[model samples]
Target: MRISRRQFGTLATASAAGLMVPGLAQAQSATGMHSFAAPAPGKNTHPLLAKRDQNAILARIQGLMKRDGVGALVIVKPENVAYSTGYVSRFAYGPGVPAGSQAAAVIPASGNAQLFINLMESDDAPRMTDDVDVTAMPGFVFVDDGTPESRQERSATIDPLAGFKDALAAAQDMASDGKIGIEKGSLLAGLLAYLNSQVPEDRSLNSEDLLYEARLIKTPWEIDILRMAAQHAERMMSRVAQQLEPGMNALVLENMIRAAGWAEDKEYSMSNMAFQIGIGPYWGVSGSNRNYEIKQGDLMRIDGGGTHFGYISDITRTWAVGGSPTSKHEEIYDALYAGFLKGLELLKPGVKMSEMYAEVRAEVEKSPLLPTYARGHVGHSISLSPLLEDHPLFAPGFDVEFEPGMCVSLETSYMAAEGSYAPGPYNIEDSFVITESGYDRFTTVPDSLVWDGSLTTQ
Candidate 1:
């Protein structure tokens, strides 16, 4: 459905107009400042898929498809499909990423491509991609006897999996014995079972590595949008600072912080934009419940982002609500800052992604209060999804090297409590990218938590 410009404006940041009181409980009037214009919408005018980086993607897929000797590549992963076709599917999330019967854009050895989608999605799927040609097939359609004998008719109806099954059947009908590459991770169990059950003896089915490999590097346009996302996030951080105070509900604070992001006018159409807010001791993670009442000495963590064009932007900041932070609070905050700087110092093109993670880990270990629990990995690569490089080089799992265009999350977590040896953990995550010398931080939140010292009298 086309969201009216007015509706889109509300969803964007246009709603955050005037300055309001600092704390949620009090009814103090805010002084209008030249700075608070409520963020304008973003300026990204195009969709990521509209750019059609398909040739590069196709080249990457060719090797995998050829290695598997697959004639047709049937992709079902939402991120995979978006990467391949620039078609971000909102439907993918509705039924969960894996369970949906979303069909892949069919890439044959030499003919045109076709996209198969569910009957319900027949209308919505076409708008997803501006580049590739698309066709919709219902679960099944049949021809009944008509008054005229000379004309043979065609009818079709679709099952949930009809889109995927039809694409496969079509492929097989054209080339019976050719290999079909299926993204095993994406194919639902039921769909896999059906494919296994119905496949003819002549055809060979196997999993292929086409989509995963293409996601490793991002295009220039993708990088540009990610940068724009960071800019919006930085603006959101400032908005949160103005609203930081004691007594604000977690949800209210979160909604306000996100509203600040929407305040900026978007130049392009953003796809899959997301925002998160965590108050109190938890700075980075939002599982701490929405709108937890802001308490004295509580640190407020506001994280938010909107896509640049279609490239995702994810960034975060932590603020000290009410007055100036205590000495101990400052120490804990400083420790995180140090860790962030350490990570950034090591983040650069040609540097091993693991080396940067190790630097952060080493710095954290040097602190007087050694963490009992394993601190999660420092950062990750993100292009399609917000957290692409979640695993650190030092951590077990994927170890991807840094390249020029890849974006990353430089996050730090630490725990501190007054009078107690075991301090609760506080985390702050921000978006950054590898540069020639080191890296550039996208978030503009104050590196140190600001406490205004004393309360103001009216």
Candidate 2:
């Protein structure tokens, strides 16, 4: 199973298993946007999507269209592309981060959803999603290669400009002479130049914030998928904990987690995995090159994650190399844990991100285990992308409020012991879904620094 790229906390607790179902009264097209009403909750509208809450989805689309000073949207980022079309991108930009990929989703304020992709997925991409119309670009195909039986996909080669002309035409139709809202941060300069060549410069703007804000709120169906994703994340984390030993290489552990996920029947479209390896203080973000070793007392922190069902899970856990966390280890964990609890306690609908950060930081500052500096949100809206996505990051003036169907990570970290990777902070993260009253957690890992000492010897 492939891991697809794919949060916590209101103190108000709800049954983690009891999903908060919302009744979407169809796509309200009163504002002249695409009106799509998802199938009733608990439905299999597509191969992977069990719920197609069109109302929830259209609400986001409407939000983006209604962004002040914006008139239309061109969603090209992998995260947003998947969000609208349910077409998880198999495209990889590599370490160099290419300027553009041959994929996009053109969403008009008052029509249908148009998903553009490489030629490779043209044949079956529509089968992977619901609602949106799929348009595969030219010159590539989604393939599995490098081996005979049960071959694995390396990646698809793309003609950077393929189908872009047609895509621009679609965007033009959506824009309908309105200011074109492009993904400025990601819709590369080349693409932008091309788009600008076609449209009036005065009629374009960066609508990243609008798209992000729209994506922040999840529908009941999306929440269910996120919940499943979190469980898969815990399984991967548990594998690392269970197989952890004094002599295994980081590569081995990486493969172990991947295998464990497949063993659990987890399948995803695109995902990446990297971890900080080596003994404490020497931690470095190492790949699975098979060189780094895990010493008896090394604190191996996995700062990176992969995807599941096109939705990435942001779960970080620092394990004591030999298990049975020492008092010193516990102290560091406690400091970070303080923020986790405070984040949860203060997390309710209408609560500001700034407020959450201030309160959580107040508690985190109480711990001597931390360094002098601290920044970032105690929690951030999560879905599709794992980092500070959906305009996440509780900085000053982030006036957004927690809303139902929103998911976030109750994230916290600290510098346990410094060395080559001086002041490397211990990473602790989990997922939660905001609901009608409280929230629903995705990961079930224990929230304490303590793990059974006996597991070290397993």
Candidate 3:
């Protein structure tokens, strides 16, 4: 387990190279498309080989299946497919691909799982993991290399419909009389019809809720990835904050945030959508605008983050534009920060989410500067989904208890009304993983409200 840095680097390089499909580069070049780059290794570890525990994940899935009386799960959603089989397909994630052409994972409660993918990804699918068997369906006709093995592979490709039927049959055989759970929302109409013809409607179940339940608890590997994601977001925000000056609009700042991600070979997941830049009276509106220029004495608010290997980071920081924050700014920020700190203190295991929300709300109300401040929720869970927030929100009436291995975000935000004192949004948010005792914070940026223009671009 104690691998030297040089050995780890070699192993990481080999793992990256192993994920390339045969003739992929040539195919990309012939089609005038850029070749996809392998995900960059984390700063301190090989994320996949060193941290990802495929066995642990599968065990958790099977345990949940048993508890739900689901004998088998047919996963068609791209995220669930990757979670089950470790095969992250580019075509599956892209919008141009037809519904039936994307990859799927069939996992039984007590046996080996199967990954059904298009023929083009056959080479890379097996390299993703040895825990599941790969079944390549008919799609993506490749030029024959004339090798015996290549010829055999091409000859073995069957009709796509037939392939789907065979996979369903295999699942039924493995499960016997047990109920089959399928991600009904992600299946194509034709595929669903075919499945209906094979399995009785009474025996079929929608697996969406079960899948979400499985993902609610973060594995150690997932926590590590989320930690790295938060670190990247903090670094990106710091870089963006340094370049903040008068006359710069929201669009320019948004692009700088994206550029920071690209510079580190990371994908900008939130991009322009979840990125909120508020100035003046537009405090509650989300997204960036080209016309909103930063002015001295304007309280600037930024709330966003990026992804690292599919896991997301959601952090918010607000500060002055070019000079010291006004007294009103200090008053509001101090109130919100107090709520944020109280939330952090209550983030330990066994605390109910609703109790935390109530406590944080009471703490914020204690501040005379904003006694009437209110919010629906202080924060929510964070994970692989691009939608950002996940289940068990820190809101009223949510009675879910905090558990170890759950990744969450805690925030204190106030969007002032137009013409109110220091009319703008004020926010302080960070990501954390609930631990055995308390929680470990992922974001490290200073929560100070003053922006003195002291930061320099890296």
Candidate 4:
């Protein structure tokens, strides 16, 4: 279908709004936030994703199965599917299909897992995903009224759950112990009920905790892919800021970045990005979608995440619109950076995420420029797009210690006090992963704004 530039921007901008960190009413004020655009989808797979280590992923799942006595895990969540199978099928994810397709993975007690796919994705499965035992819904002729001669397409076009039963039947056979696992959080009640009915007993139980526990930590290959995503975000931010002109609307930056990413991919399914102007709560087009023209002396906050191989790279930086930072701005940034830097240092293996949050809050409180709307925490895990963690930030957790492979976003968020001469929200963010010793920073963008109130090169 043909879409006008204006319409496309509106639709895509709505999608990118999902990247915003949930909190506050996201109330809008006079100033605004920048909306980020994502690249179109690409068919050519990246080498990194094409070579994802299947054994490492399977081992983690198998280890959990052995310990929990789970005969199999019916994986449906897109992130979990990708993590387990190392596949990047477009069929696995789509709008409105939040937890992935109606399909599920029938992981047996041993050997390769059975990947049940929807009719629409059956053909794309073999070409796009990793080599695995792929069972797709049977294709049938799709008759359309537009056929002058015969506008009909035949392929896997039958029942959406046709292939699912096969996998479910297999799971029923393997789950003799009557203990199968599924992501309770992601699956709907109807699906869960159906799954239970399919099995001899109500054996399916929530197992997302174990799955995330394993995925929280990154592998060497995954880290590299995340790094590539980070670089893309950094460059996109610079490119957007460079082209900014007075009176240009907030969407200008978003569209520019979108164009740049579109050069790489056309379908923006796997990527996420956002920008915020120093418009207090009313900033960035991310949540607001307002059309605010640019002005000098305004602040521009670039909060974005680049997706490479389906991994996310989250990074944030702020700039003074006129290319000159006022002393007040510098003062606020200094205080924010100090606490955030120390928080990064505290990210060592075995260190609980809660301890680090307390330490950071204490440090930030020490600054005379006390936070006005501070949340008394640092940040959360930067998992696959739209699938982040709930804790390890904000407050102490259930003794979940820092592991060597989990990627997280180190950030400081606070709005200026009413009386104080503060910028909109005093914030900065970057992505990093805990290492065996300390941490490996995936986002290379510097926290400091240079003399021009902009970053030159980091």
Candidate 5:
């Protein structure tokens, strides 16, 4: 458990090498197009895990239900579904998929978990899951738009609210008289309204409060995967920084980051990437903007995240598009870095998340050059998805405690005064995790305003 700095370095190198193996070999083959599903058979192919890690996850859910005193736990969130069962689907509104029926995975309190994936995604479920068996065996329950009979109902024909009802019914059969603990905030407005129709006019259904309190802590297996993901994000950011040029637009910069994540050993690379970028005060800019160019003086902030084996790595780096950093930028960068490190020092088992935020906020407050933009604390725990969707962000009243097994993002940023005539304000951010004794940076970008060759063409 005591991994020395040297051991960490060795482990990092070994991990990087392991990631590169499948990535490099797959690049030469025709089927390399397959995303990070189960690797096709190859020399020493890793076994596709089947129902091995279910006990811990199931136990966690059962305990959560008992401690919370809920008769049935209804899991509707995609991330929660992925956590309970290793299956992930492209349920997002994209391409040919209908905007509605967004593929959903659900686990009931007492019965089999079900996945309502489009026919296209049924096969990918098993390959993606480590445990929590899907009922349809190697395939998921396909919901086609064509008919309610096939479950492939179109977004228009089969109401998602109805599907939810059916899922609840499946769970209801297991515990008919007990209070059902629906994952609060998870049911869509329409679905909630529909479910209300079925409830007796006199009865109130008990829904579970946000379930992420238990999920805030990561397990060793989860941490290991996150470590790999962070490495990929860091290396990708570094490599992309090396590729940035004066004229490259947001789109190009974003692609470079994405490519680095997928450029790993082809076998374990990500299928897609998500990002945001900006030069001025606005921190939420994103996507491919081939036209907007990166100039020499632009304070480039690229916030990117990548996934490996479904686990995610969220990272951010703000630096000069070129190698030069304005003194002001450096000052802000130093403040932000200091805040991040201070938070890292405070991050450990037994510390409340709010306390860590307070530590970072206090550090930022002392910086003469920084703004009061230290709105919240440094970061929060991460898992199979980005930002954990709607979890707390270093705010008060959130009493979640950090534990050794959890992976968290140490994100901290400062709003700077607008340059005399520049676009506006700017900020810097990054991510890291609490470790057994200390912390580990997921995206290993150097905490400096000067862009090292890692992200610049100098």
Candidate 6:
């Protein structure tokens, strides 16, 4: 179901008042952002999957298909397949897996959906969602017990091509007017050739644009997942920040961040923890070096993220190592924060991303302290991708307007020259969900130049 603007406004108000939606209360209580009870167990499904509105997502896809005059979509990208079918495949995680062995989802614009997956995952994939008709293909040889059910479920061929042909025929039958959209980049050459021979070239259109368009505006369920992911990352970062002390190298800090996240059964993503000490142009460096020790007054800049379910969180913060910030340090941070706040102020429905970028860039350029400050983009959309930055970046020439239910990250950074007076990187970043009137921020850590030791005190 789509959330009306009025409903969204009320929900935003409730969220601000610390009354979060179901399935998020436990995270809120753990982070002290809100008072809530633990979520109850889901029946035969992952908690996040139980929270997802599959109907809403399918309706969105159908709407986009109707608008584009497309009939059906053959989704094969690991991320896209997961988004459409709610079945996270193990093949997407490790290396050396054949391209043809990947799972695919055949979604019709006006009817039931079909998921083509490996037979080994047949039992688990159905538990994630019951909205799709699963077609399990033979992936590995198994010594099955002589049971009637096992014999009936077994496929005749182990060839992936045979399964692809079956799925393609099914998609054609479901197509509205013989027009199908396929992800060429994710398909094997043999599969693509077969698709070409079966369907005319004009009828087989690229599904990338259509799929991305549908995913651009998130449903209410997606927003909740993003919010929870952001909170998880912030909590881990806070713990790591509190442990910072003299002589602690990047290795130590990185381990702390990983340990904190893994302890809660979450995964790290997107540079994990890119750290920089004192000065230089190593803004995106994440390698752990024992020689690069954090000194008493060194500036520490950390840009990192963690993943929840599949949503990603990208957050950055810079501060003095020992709670002692020099005048120059504070001045630089003030400039960055000013620009960040300007971006936040401009983050509302109907605002163009490029317009926001220009305004924020102008605000930061006004500061005399950062005469050399420059950036290509201030922020980007954050979601299911393994990469931190998604599409429609907050950069010049991107004219996508902010819409309610869109979640994005707003960030800006400055790295002074090696011998400059205020040397080192100064940065700030946070995630937010665009609302009806304004935006709801995800991270709650204070934007301070010095760590207040709040985590330690608690």
If both were scored by lDDT, which would come out higher, candidate 1 or candidate 3?
3
The prediction achieving the highest TM-score against the true structure is 6
Best by lDDT: 3
**Each prediction's Cα lDDT score?**
0.57, 0.61, 0.71, 0.62, 0.57, 0.70
Estimate the TM-score of every prediction.
0.73, 0.76, 0.78, 0.78, 0.76, 0.81
Clashes of each: 46, 21, 0, 23, 20, 0
> Could you give candidate 1's per-residue lDDT for residues 311-377 as a string of tens digits?
5666666666775566776777676777777877777877676676777877876766544325667
For model 2, residues 163-253, the per-residue Cα lDDT tens digits are 6667667777777657777777775677777878887878888778777777787777777776766666566566556656677655455
| TM-score winner between candidates 1 and 2 | 2
Rank by TM-score, descending?
A: 6, 3, 4, 2, 5, 1
Task: Output candidate 6 Cα RMSD.
Answer: 9.9
lDDT order of candidates, best first? 3, 6, 4, 2, 1, 5
RMSD of each: 8.6, 12.2, 9.2, 8.7, 8.6, 9.9
lDDT score for residue 13 of model 2: 18
lDDT of 4 at 72: 81
Model 5 residue 225 CA deviation in Å: 1.8
* Candidate closer to the true structure by lDDT (higher is better), 1 or 4: 4
For model 6, the stretches where C-alpha displacement exceeds 4 angstroms are 1-43, 96-100, 141-164, 188-191, 264-282, 286-291, 415-421, 452-458
Which residue ranges in model 2 land beyond 4 Å of their true spot?
1-46, 67-71, 92-101, 140-159, 249-251, 266-279, 288-293, 371-373, 386-390, 417-425, 445-447, 452-458
lDDT of 4 at 398: 41
- Quote the positional error of residue 114 for candidate 1 in Å: 3.5
